[model samples]
Target chain A: MAALLPITHLLWDTWRGNLTVNPLQDWTFRTGDWALRLLVASLACTPIATIFGFKQASSVRRALGLYGFGYAVVHFFIFIGVDYRFAFDLIWDDLATKRYILVGLVALLIFMPLAITSTRAWMKRLGRQWKQLHKLTYIAVPLAVVHYIWLVKADLRDPLLYATIVAVLLLLRLPWVRTQISKLKYRRVFQKL
Target chain B: MAPKKTIMKIYSSEITPEQTYYAQSQSRRQFFKTAGLVASGALLSACAPSTPSTVDPAPTAIKPEKPVTAGQTDELGDAITQYDAISNYNNFYEFTTDKQGVAQMSAGFVSSPWKVQVGGLVNNPKTFDIDDLRKIAPIERIYRMRCVEAWSMVIPWSGFTLSNLLKQVDPKSEAKYVRFETLLDSNRFPGQRDRSFPWPYTEGLRLDEAMHDLTLLATGIYGKPLLPQNGAPIRLVVPWKYGFKSIKSIVKIDLVAEQPTSLWMKSGPSEYGFYSNVNPEVSHPRWSQSSERRIGEMARRRTLLFNGYADQVASLYAGMDLRKNY
Candidate 1:
């Protein structure tokens, strides 16, 4: 958090003059994009840890999850505090009428349980069920992308790029990739079979 | 040399001693008293409510001789006043796209020294100064201005009918269209330097529409000389059209035989039509125009066709297909 100040200040100064996008919208989009990227990064950690045979990579999962939540919180606050001016009626109307808003809210709601149970105590309590519950991120991520695509009016280029990145990350989890990994395993049980 | 130096030193010492003594005695007392009085005066002024004299007076120089008639001042005076403030503070994108930026930057415009050049297909090619144009004729009409963005405002504008002004210009037999140009000054208007919009903002109307009684060459709003933000010096006010059709800070009025290209229409033809009327049924591809929030209304409300002036200006487009033209 302390290290992020300089980068945040640099972004603020750079966008002070540009009026093509409003400052609030720019901040929301950047934060939301960063959250989506962090979610993809967290998903990559499990795959990377398994491939390299490193136990240390698994420990960073909690930090990555918290970072994604932090960005989501920033994005949520910006929408409520600045964009809607904390008006409940307007927010209610947006949530009801706007498809993108509804999708985003649902994604956030799904992530809330995962984020709350990210701690070691909750993990120890839930034990086997914890991993199953955290898998909801895979669903949450695609919903987030859909929320973004529906929000944009005409420009699909940025959203398309995000979709492509997400697709590649999800493809790494396919059965073919898992089968290749199994063939390369050093365990003798495979040879006996 | 020793005698002269000693005399000069004695003179400087004498002046310093006398000044120090005065500062230590009467001057210090006087200074403290004056400071105390000033502080108390400031305290008293801060405690008092601002009276009329203390408040900045509304610009009195441009007040119209004829007061607002009873009929014109309807039950919506408060709403009209709020609309006046919003409309007068506008940065109609045609002049400059930035809403608040244009207000401050347009101060450098020399409105009084300006002239409108009327020529092209007109029988008499003549330039009229601001005063000459003001004296031609004056009419006060309250009309609703609806923006392409779906915000609306009801403004009481003081101006001569565009038809009356056109009569003075005397259109030639071949004249079929009228094009308007806003003054271009990059130094005065920083928005002019912005490439988001093309320079020398232009709008056009058909000759018949230009000559319509509802079309006005406005000089004032709320019975006062227009502020720079509201297109001071001169602006066009076409009541039935979307606000963009009413060009601002006009410098040239050209009557032409061919249809002139408008700025927005040239940029995005499908989004902005040449005949940009205030038709709620005709929605812009980007957003619905089925409703508009009046500037000061507590809640967003439905927009009226022709901005509720169908009785006055609907006949102009009676036989034509509005959807196709739109």
Candidate 2:
């Protein structure tokens, strides 16, 4: 339910005529931005659960990943469907020439299987294979960040900041780092209690 | 009206139908009615009247005419972009990098007491007041501004030709290029504080490009004094080149012996070139420039070589490799 807010806010802005002069660019950027943020947030869930010992955090990871995938689909739809008007020639030209768009497409492709197998039936069927396949989140998040950093003309602060967060979250997921931090955190919690 | 009549002679080929132009003009005026009320109210309380306005120009000088003339559109017959969109959406990186945010960030910016210094390798060096510069030969020009980011706008700008200004300060025999520098006050322009860019943003053009009659030193837009975000007081309008080549809020003009490296060229030598002419065939390093979305239009149109100004400016770059130069 909370995932609907970004699109709702965008629709309200569109209705109010409060969008930027180039509404298409605004829509594309906003949707892409939300997709990246949600995907990164999905990546951060396990790290948070391990480090802070919040067991409940892992439960929503699937939902967050699904939401991120949903936004990515809309982002691509806006680009190829609305903006390009399904002009395969122009779209093909962009895919061939534009590096950032190509990277974004690859990242979206990675998210697709993860989103499709998110159901409990599929997850249980795949079992350990599902976990290994979903590990591709680690790859998808960084590619999305690279897509952002490459697309921006000069300012890299926003994208770089996301890159740093993703780096730290990934570092925390390392077995040694996770076990050490988790032990230290639980020990401190018991002392406080 | 006399000034308007004379300026129309320059763009006598404008072929927009009379009825379509009238309907557009009527709706434009209606938009201005609401926009002007809000603008005047905000402008009155926020800033003093030191900023020159076409609303009340000196009786002796040519003032920008309104209701833009019948069939007065760009050479491509593209309808003039709405004044609100043109003013409200800007790429004045001095204030902010966000296109729509520049207007709000530049609120109450003071462009008064501005003096543009014309010197360096010139026979006659002079510093002219911004107002005096506008008086030289202010005329309205409808131009298609294509950004390197694959977006474009059709704007009606009011200013004199850069050739008129360049001629005043006669270039020395060895002067081969013209370098321009923006005002460097970090306090007024917050974006300068960021070290990512070499501030007092600098840009340059070849001497012949600077002398082209089509190149304008714009001081106003939409028949009004330029808004702060639109590079008020004075800016350059090189229609053939990408929009960034038309630098804003200029303070210094130098006729140099060598091609001066512009800020973009210094920052990304591979992406931006000295001549940043608009050519669809030569794409930017990261993005395709084969097509562009006009500000109001939804679908992308084929990007034109030299932004549809090739007829007038192509001779200037004859026998040269535009791809190499770009």
> Which candidate comes out best when scored by DockQ?
2
Query: On a 0 to 1 TM-score scale, where does candidate 2 land against the true structure?
Result: 0.86
lDDT of 1: 0.69
Across B162-263, the per-residue lDDT of candidate 1 in tens digits comes to 888788879999999999999888766666776666678899999999997678898976656766788888999987788888898899999998888887
Compute the DockQ of candidate 2.
Answer: 0.52
TM-score of chain B of each: 0.74, 0.82
Candidate 1 displacement at residue B197 in angstroms: 2.3
Global lDDT of each model? 0.69, 0.83
Can you give the DockQ of every candidate in the order shown?
0.11, 0.52
lDDT digits (tens) for residues A57-109 of candidate 2? 89888877888888889999999888888888878888887899899999999
Locate the minimum summed-lDDT window of 10 residues in model 1 chain B: B5-14
Give me the candidate number with maximum TM-score: 2
Model 2, position A72: C-alpha lDDT score:
88
For candidate 2 chain A, the 10 contiguous residues with the lowest summed lDDT are A44-53
Question: Chain B alone, model 2: TM-score?
Answer: 0.82
Off by over 4 Å in 1: A1-193, B1-78, B81-89, B93-97
